[model samples]
Target: MQFSIAFPLAALTLLISTITAQAPGSQCGGIGWPGIMFCNPGSVCSKINDCEGLHGSLADQM
Candidate 1:
């Protein structure tokens, strides 16, 4: 029983993590934006100044 529960829990965690990973050039954060803020591997969240406010963009690795 414990094994059955643990397997589902682990799968859910992995699914959630993948869902939150943002691709390069994707928006990760900004004022009033309620979404994932983590960038995928080889990318970093960067601030982009716009008229509204500071937004986040996934910058590719240098």
Candidate 2:
């Protein structure tokens, strides 16, 4: 039916618009949203707390 084609067309348009309308990214250590571009290369987007080293550390040499 027409419903099937219309549904897929609408979904495709929405997906394309969302992808194309993305905003620019910020640099490393810059203040950005958690889900957004919050960091850059050679850096991470982690909470700077006392237990920072315990999170991203290696557990085993495997």
| Model 1: CA > 4 A from native | 1-16, 50-61
Off-target runs (Cα >4 Å) in candidate 2 are: 22-62
lDDT of 1 by residue, 9-49 (tens): 99888778767786666677777667776655455666665
Q: After superposition, how far is residue 14 of candidate 2 from its true place, in Å?
A: 0.3
**What C-alpha lDDT values do all the predictions have?**
0.62, 0.40
With a 3 Å backbone cut-off (N, CA, C), the pairs that clash in candidate 1 are: none
Task: Estimate the Cα RMSD of every predicted model relative to the unseen true structure.
Answer: 4.8, 9.9
Clashes counted in candidate 2 amount to 0
